[model samples]
Structures are given as C-alpha cells and as structure tokens.
Target: MPRFALLLAAGLLACAAQAQATSFVMTTDALAGASVGVSESTSDLSSSFGDDKIVLAARDDAASFVASDGAIRGARLEAALRHIRERAPQLDADDRQLARAILVL
Candidate 1:
C-alpha cells in the first residue's frame, strides 16, 4: 500500500541521517603519560599488606576464623588486624573487610 511504502521510506531516511550525523575521532592524547616501561605483577596479593606480613602470613588462620561465625572465635583475624594496625596504621579497614580480602586474595 502507498501508506506503508511512505512510512518505510521515511524510516530509512531517518536512520541514514542519524548514521551520517555520528562521527568518531581517534587520538593518542590520553596515552601521552602512559608508560609501559615497568609493569608490576598483581599475582602476589601479600604485597598489598606492605610490611604487615602477619596479615598475609595468617591468611590460612584467618580463613578458619572466618569459617567460625561464633562470637568467641576469630582470634586469628584479630591477631592479623592488630599486626596490620601496628605496622601500617594508615590503612582504614576492619576485621570483616580483612576476612573477605583474606578469603579472596
């Protein structure tokens, strides 16, 4: 029908106009400060703890402590938190966060 034909033609023209209105420009300006000279590996999760090696060392114990949800448990996690606070006092984290991080990392 003539009406359907007219609608199809208008839709096609609108789509074509939209396609032409869009433009893409590629540039290397963002990579100006990027340096691939030295890249650090992230495989070592213990490095995130810095000098607070106890946190990394007690990961297994922390995992066990986390498994026990009782209030009287979590001695290992507490010890790790104390070590982290003593060595790296600047870190802003709690036992729950440390437990999660220990499980994942």
Candidate 2:
C-alpha cells in the first residue's frame, strides 16, 4: 500500500511539473462529461462548449463540414482545435488523439 501511494504521488508530481499553467484530472472517455470535475483551467472546456454557442460533434461529420466552408455557422475545424488547446493549455498529444474525432470550441 505504501509503495502504491508513493508511486501515485510521484506520478502526480510529474504531471504537475509538466503543465505548470494549471492542473486537471481529465477523463479518458470519448466525450468527457461535466459533472466529474476538472482543474479550473480545463473546467472551462466542460462549460464553455456547452454554455456558449460552441458545438461539439464527432469527426464522422468533420470532413463534410470542412468541405462545406460555411456549414455549422462557419465554424472551421481549425478554430475548434485552437479553441480547445487555448482554453485547455494542459492538453497533451495523447489528448489530441482522443480529440481527433471530436470538434469542440
């Protein structure tokens, strides 16, 4: 038990050191929900995308939207990715993988 605790602490320390801007406990699910909670920095993603006019959808429709140019209120794919990365500065490459199939702003 003590060894497990030590390892967990070490892992947390590493994450903290990596993204010093803000901390978060993000979900690994395809579409992370709002209730579980995250660091204040990432917390905005859970709220802004839902609260604001931002629309989040699966990449299954992205190719078509990208082709349309003005589809979905002219919300370009690049804008969505930029929005997420900007608001959630702690996002990593792996998170990008999970986000590849989703558009969020």
Candidate 3:
C-alpha cells in the first residue's frame, strides 16, 4: 500500500510538472547556405520584417514588374543597394551580385 501511494504521488507530480512546462514561440529561420548580397551582420536578422521584402522580391523579380500598366518601379532598390554598400563597406559589386544570386536561389 505504501509503494502504491508513493507511485501515485510521483505520477501526480509528473503530471503537474508536465502541465507547468514552459513553451515559446520560436521562429529562428537562418538564411540559405549560399546567397548573393550576403548581409554578414544578419545576426539580428531573425524576427526582423525588413528581410520579408527580399523574399517578396524573389517571388516577383524586376523583369516581371513591367510599367505597361503604368506602375513604375521605385528607386528603392538602388537606394537600398547604396545603403548596403555603405553598411558593408567590404561588399563590392561582385559580392553584392553573388549574394543577390544566392538570395534569388
């Protein structure tokens, strides 16, 4: 009877522990293995909505975005590229292009 009571207490504790287990909303998606326009300072990239634009861009390339319907492409790309060059001073045109290729992949 003592062994049975001890087992019952242990089972209750286990159930309580399981019920109190902490959970988190984890969303840590790392970048591709290889990509062009590599932002090496992407340690804080996760959880940032800024990178979502890149994904959208990959889905809809510049070529597909035509001005036939009178919707002109913004100069944001050029500006963003310039900003990137400034931030990653070592990232040359070639590196940027390579990173871009990786991103598009």
Candidate 4:
C-alpha cells in the first residue's frame, strides 16, 4: 500500500508539471486596421483602446487582442517590442533593433 501511494504521488506530480508547461493562446482585433502603423511605446499602444474596441482573448498562458478600428497601432506594436526586450536578452543587438522597428510599425 505504501508503494502504491508513492507511485500515485509521483504520477500526480508529473501531471502537474506537464500542465504548468502548457502554452496558451489568445486573439484580439482592436488593431486590425492599424496593423500598418507603428507606435514608439507601450503606453501609446494602451491608450489606443477605446471602450470595447480592444478585445482580448486569453487562453491558459497566452493572450491575443485586436485594436479598435482606426486606432493608432503604435502603442500595441510597442508592447510586442517591449516583450522581446524583456524576454530575449540573448538576442544580438541587430536582432533587437529589428524587433524594435517591427514593434513600432
């Protein structure tokens, strides 16, 4: 009985670890139109949200959002750029620069 309990505990721990490593997905359409313009900062992206225009869909560990129609895409773009800066410091300077440029627009 003790052996069985130990095995069960191990199984439960493995399952929990697997669940924690799982990825999530999200989608939004607020920036659908301005997908072309770029913002210089995350604040710019956040301010573009008008009422319910910015819709966020979150799943597990991931989230997606769309900007409102005609809203400036710069601020939202900046956020993605900032995320790369925060999450991928190992990237080369050129890669970071490209990421920043992409985030702006």
Judged by TM-score, which candidate is best? 1
Candidate 4 lDDT score relative to the true structure: 0.39
| Residue-by-residue lDDT tens digits, candidate 3, 18-66 | 6665321121222342232344333222223245554334323322332
TM-score of each model, in listed order: 0.41, 0.30, 0.28, 0.26
Hey, what RMSD does candidate 1 come out at? 10.5
Query: What would the TM-score be for candidate 1 when compared with the true structure?
Result: 0.41
Task: State which candidate, 3 or 4, has the greater lDDT.
Answer: 3
lDDT for each residue of candidate 4 in 1-88, tens digit (9 for 90 to 100): 9999999999999998776655221122445433333333323333432121211211111112133332334454445445545654
Candidate 1 regions off by >4 Å?
A: 1-47, 50-53, 70-75
- Relative to the true structure, candidate 3 reaches a TM of 0.28
What candidate 4 gets wrong by more than 4 Å, as runs, is 24-105
How much is 16 displaced in model 2, in angstroms?
A: 48
Preferred candidate (lDDT higher): 2 or 4: 2
Worst 10 residues of 3 by lDDT: 22-31
lDDT of 1 at 105: 51
- Show the lowest summed lDDT stretch of 10 residues, model 2: 93-102
lDDT of 4 at 36: 32
| Tens-digit lDDT track of model 2 for 1-105 | 999999999999998887764434333342365323333323455565555333364343445553554354234445656666677666553333323334432
